[model samples]
Target: MAAVGVGAFALALAATWTSGPLATGIGAAASAVYALVADLLQPSQRVHAPGGALLRTAAGRVPRFGRLDRPELAGVHPADGPGDRRAPPPYVERDAEPSVRRALEDGGFVLIVGESTAGKTRLAYEVARSRFPRHAFVRPMDRSALAPAVAVARRRRRAVLWLDDLENYLGADGVTAPMVDELLGRRPGRVVILATMRSEEFRRYDAREESRLTGSDRDAWRVQRDVLNAAVKIRLERHWSEAEQLRAAAHREDPRIRLALESGDRFGLAEVVAAGPELLTAWQNAWAPGANPRGAAVVAAAVDCRRSGLRRPVSREWLQDLHRPYLAERGGPDLQPEPFAEAMAWACQAAYATSGLLIGNYSQGYTAFDYVLTASDLPPVPDHLWDALLALVEPADAYDMGLVAHQAGRLPRAAAALERARAGGAAEADFLLAIVTGDRGRPRHAARDLLRVVERRRAALGAAHPETLAAVHQWAFFTGESGEARAASAAFVRLVADATAALGAEHTDTLAARHQQAYFAGEAGEVDTAVRELAALLDVRLRRAEADHPQALAVRRSLIWFSSLRGDLAEAERELRLLLTDAERALGPHNPHTLAIRSTQAAFAAQAGRTEEAIAEFTRLVSERSRLLGHDHPHVTHSRLQRVQGLIAVGRGAEARGELTEILEEARRVLEPGHRHLVLARSLLAPPRHEP
Candidate 1:
């Protein structure tokens, strides 16, 4: 049928050479016939394999059970018989096996979270094979492979989406909440999304108080959180239970299991069998004086590269360039390091019938072993390495590194990495760079950069595209932040109308614009109007979201603030007290929203003629904020300024002056010269001298 359709298409094209109406009609009819046949003969994207065995995926070829890498495993290979070379180790059922099997059968998102060498992947593999023997597998290689693999899996009557190291698929171009929702929304028990993540990475993504995240980081974290919430999480402890140990003892006929049982007192049976401690011991011994010192340096460099946010492999040249610093720090000339080529060889040499400290060849680049990476409790990536990595890493990697730096509060390093990413043609780098610039106190600069982003996104994604609209939203926000509140308010009004028209009034983007419109209107001094609109918006938000939802809380806070502006101080205070209680209960007292409410309550007390009390509260809050969020955090700076004002009000000019000086220095170190906090601090430090 497909061949016939192709022939008909060819005939139709040939018929177009004739100019008569009859010929034209015949060509059109034939073209339509070919289209019909072509549609009928379209090839399926579904996986094709015999029942009872998983095979290929849309992402790529699937590795069989024995071929799968079991991290840190060392010892005799467990085979079916004396001569069988490709069989896996004897199966020891875990305590979570029944639950995991049930999750697979029930089908949604199943995640196994554990530390390295905890047998997470092995457990998942065993359960999936036994429970869903006929289900096809789709294993994405990276974020880029995820969507296509999912689409391909959806075509199958039953399939499994296998994601290992879940963090790799979580970010801007990665697995998102909407994607997971779409997959689960389809035939409920047909496709099971199976994933594994290290415990540390899971906690980072699972952080509840994400108020420290800004801009794109906040958006990405929200997506990750939503996906995590939807998953049936199963925690796998590194230590084996008594029942598990007994099960391993049953498999004692397998020498590997016997050896593991003997040494498994400290680590789990799986860990000992996988040679986890042996690998760690080997790596440490390599760093001894006159040992594989250069090779150890190479391993250290690779580990630090990963720690610094370089996920992909690094070239031999890159490692050679990085290892020198590690050598220098480890008594460079005194140690008399081996030659570079010899070091590379030693690092890649396999030990304990398992992987080396570093893996990969000279031509293909290298990456550190997972065991080494997880075990090393290294300090921060050196300044020199940050610069070198930013210079050497690919644009996409550089962008991710910038995000990591930004989240860690390393503003200057983030700017440098994002700048490099932008230069290397990573488009979203501009958006993140603008945010970092704003955080550094250059809102004007951020606004200009956002304008560029807006133009680029509009050209590429169209004016009404959600991403373009987001760029426009940020541009308007920074414009207002740069002291053009009226212009920003006008922009938000236009955005609200456009978003409502394009995406409907209740769409998240539209509501976001409306929220911004109301707040900026208040900033522009239309207090009564802001208050009225915010109240209406809050009602809509409460209906659509939980009362404790961040958006709803924000709207409520804005409405209360504007109501205070309308000379309703008592009502504002009452509302704030209620809000403070709710925020503390729902988001914890240390949450940013809760702290902001506390700050507002303190300010309101001062406004209501309790300056001394307000000053004392501000002082206490400043210390708490500094302790929890670091001293250079913007929240702490704002609180300090408020405290200085309170001190000046109480005739403590001497103390106020000293505090103001410190604030000025901190602002200079972390903020832009034009930042409002920096400008205010300078004014307080050098008040105008009056001429009598």
Candidate 2:
């Protein structure tokens, strides 16, 4: 509005220098030009993030190793830092540092994989800081902030997406393949994605075959696999190598390194130097004899809370309430527990003149030392702890805990926590609850839940908001899962249009909607339309992302099936063979996509009348998929069916009938009533002989 006024004023000023009709015409043209230029002058606004280092060079915030505070190191907390004590030691370079720096310098996703306190975060931060010292640094607190953080980094030109402890940003509504592709492809070398993950967490995402997962695990892993695959992974060993220890010996001038060296080759140099084992030992010893058993219980409660995904610090009052069950479980009054004040003091006492079992003061509340979580052999989180945590933790914390529980396969507990979170007005819980509901095999219920969430989100956050759009996307998926393929296809059509308008035609979300649109279109029997749509989408994805990118590969996979359905079986088989080569080269022979393509090729061969060759191929594919994804997985079922068909073709009807009977029984139990596989298996089974 202000720009329009200024444009009018400019028009009037210009008109004063001209004459009559020409003056009026010139002024009008000048006015239009002024307004157009004003509209084009809009610049990128710097959005403020509450946490993480904002190392924007334009603002003079440059990142230095220690002087500029790094994101809290992997194990060390703010309360555990070297304050009065001399700086622990100069950083001994890890073996993976060169590879890490190389990845950072090249500007793409770089993941440092290691166990806790193996110095994943430290290695990533140091390498990133050294490489991109002046670039903006963004560390989103959770998955919710990821897209916005990426946007901020994009605007800053040179930036780093710092994802320390990468688990917090994974799973549903988390970072995925397309997001990474856009970030890396759009800006190229202007930005870098630096992340750290625990070795176990990385392994969970590194699934060789998608059939190994079912329901929500399958859905989540599909995206996670692509994202992890895109990353240049650098592994850091928990125990330092002999060369690393010898290098640490040179730094023994620092007493911490000298002390750590005295432990021989048993532990990581950083783990020992950071007092991780000592703090854990101190906490455990507090449980023995007449020591602070009550205090140990309090710390144990805190650790369990942390393990349960409560990232925020808890109050002493809440800890007091939570610790009682632990105290009672460990012999109750017979343990001769100390007074609350005395116990609190003992638990807070520092170990090795460094960190205490539980860190933080009264003001900040208390958090269990992070190292204790990595080092200890704690049991599964008890029901009492889950019950108490849901009751005491805030809605946001409960939401986080719910996600962790859902990821850990504790569905009932996850549902309960997510329900509490929803009741407390945590909007994200609604979408997650819908996913959890679907995971529990209640697709109709899940669709209804998502419908409500979509309506509410649209009303509250506007129809164009990403969260609302995401809810709509999931609701469409659940609608399809509930057997409403036509409705889901229609939903994706509208979503594609809306997402294109809001997030641009080339945006990942828009492309994702297009992919889904093609899928449901095929499912709804519009195979020709699906083929055209997927082919176009694949072209766009190939232009933007690498040819080997997951989205592109997925589009090609769908297109092949649709093409086959369109009666271009020979062409489809040839395309599938080409796709198999690319899949094997990019994703490995054992990857789900590669295996699926091979299975399809074998099926095509059986259809093409090469029974002997197809039988052998199906035999191997079935065995491999069964081993990876389990015998009951849909992929295995499909392969076994193909093999049975091969047996029938080769005049082994009796053998085929026996296998078909077993498959029909298994399908009846594992598949939905209307599932195509179940229908196929039942149809293939011959009727029992009528003994008149």
Candidate 3:
């Protein structure tokens, strides 16, 4: 269709060059013929052609000038010529406040006010379009044109008059009291007026006049502001952490960029330019240090602020505002300034050398960055500082940070931090040390260390104490994770008994102990007992903790896995749906927990009869996991295997085969050959071939 239209247009132009007046007549006649043919053929009926067919079909339906098509008229009125037709107003997508749309629908005039680029004009157009879809839309060029446009719209009786950037129209006179009174007194009809103004400008209008026109006095405006504030919602946009950002910069194939990211200095585009060759050299270094650009920036800024006589410890808000202009001046867009500032604040707050008197307080606030910042500035050698710093050195804190660093694949740092923390006298320090040692391939030492922590905690705090029992439980779990199943089972049995007695059978702590016991039982070749224990615990959790609670959802997920092991795919799928819905609502749509549930559901769906649905779900899950968790993460690899299985079940065997081959290669690289996930990947590859 597009090709045919282009051909006709070319012919029309050729005819025009040959003869002026007669050519114009020929062009008009040709356009009419084309329009008739389009009407008869019904352009919408053609769908198989690619490229511009859809565009041609849409253009063919637009209102024309006299008998001439829209395109023919456009050719006559060239875009740049004086008095040439302006392009039809851009279609504004209806995607804003529902209340504003409702008011427009009910024939009420609207005055929208917000900061510039706050989507005010776009929102106004959307509301107008939705309310008067079939009517002509007249937008006045300025305020002087508004009254005339409104008069025309009123006469038309089915038109909407919009005055965009209405503040410009109001001028210094401030929406004159008399003019507003006249507008309010105008007779009601099909015509409606919609306008937008800056919030500050709107305030300058006479109160009585504004009230009469907008039907909202100053008190009402305050109420609206309060309501807007109360109902404002925040959405989390995807952002990279400092470590992730460094990894991304490294992957971009620019050595200088990699080095700048790794320097742990305050990094913006300027720093990248400044570091140039040094950055490249650092990237080339075989063992360059991990980047802490955010951290360095925070420290640098804090020092500068203090030196400049700023009273407050460099705050996250202050750092962000300072960095904004710096980044802008360096020709860089504002990107994750908050996190970078937060990282700086944390460094200043956590700096061990900062005076306690200046630090003020150290507490585990909502954000880890805040906690670290508060901890860093503790006073030198004060009793509270000593106590707080001692607490920081405790095994629990060290162990937590160590585990996080380890999971993030910073093994050396995790090991060093854990070792230092253990040395500072954490009762659970040995447990953390054991895990780090195991990660470093010293399994025997790891097991020994874990056992020592359990023994020492039991001896010092007594076997019944929460700390002693927790140590015992974690030691056993880590032992199993490290591949010492027999020893782990023995530890688990003791943990189960002690936890049940001390924490009570239904307590979450005891339930956690039982959960570990179930896992150990499965490893020790007691599958039936494991299933029984897990089922009982799941039932209790469902009844006690709401199904959506994280702990309860976790237990439900376990039940699905156990059911799958027992070849009860139907039951597994039912549980997966419930868990998926609960996780989606509680943890949010794209959260890791929800993604895990979706992955499980995909596997179960394939196992059941919903193969096509399974394939679709798995495909989405694999893509999301790859984007969010990285392709090499265990979860992503697992999801790929599930996807292959889903594809095979849906009879897309060729595609499944290719996916299986990829999964096999990935699994070999990232997992032990004997790993359960690797085995699953292999199983998916064994399916027979068939067409999609």
| Candidate that scores best on lDDT | 1
Tens-digit lDDT string for candidate 3 (470-586): 566656765776566767767777877887889888765677777777767777777777788888877887778556555566667766686678786777777777778877777
Candidate 1 residue lDDT tens string, 1-692:
66565755655553443222222211122333443343235322211212122223122344332332321111122221222223456878999888888777778899998887688888888777666656765665455667677887788777778887787677546676678878877888888888888886676554334444543223324546667878999999888999999988898887777877887788877776666677777767877777778888888889888777776667776887888988888888677677776787677655554445675443234778666667756677788888888887778788878877776656777789888888988748888889778766677889998999899989998999777787888888888888788999999999988888888999777887888888889999998889889989988978875587656776788898889987879999999989988787777887666777889889998889899989988988898877665677777898999888888878899999999988887778777567788878877778669999
Please give the lDDT score for candidate 1: 0.72
What range of 10 consecutive residues in model 3 has the weakest lDDT sum? 362-371
Question: What TM-score do all the candidates reach, one by one?
Answer: 0.68, 0.56, 0.40
lDDT of 2 by residue, 63-83 (tens): 222333323322233223234
The worst-scoring run of ten residues by lDDT in candidate 2 lies at 19-28
* Candidate that would win on TM-score: 1
Candidate 3 residue spans exceeding 4 A from truth: 1-430, 433-449, 459-462, 482-490, 519-528, 542-546, 564-568, 609-612, 626-631, 645-674, 678-692
- Looking at model 2, residue 90 earns an lDDT score of 62
In the order shown, the candidates' Cα RMSDs to the true structure are 14.2, 17.4, 29.0
Instruction: Name the better of 1 and 3 by TM-score.
Output: 1
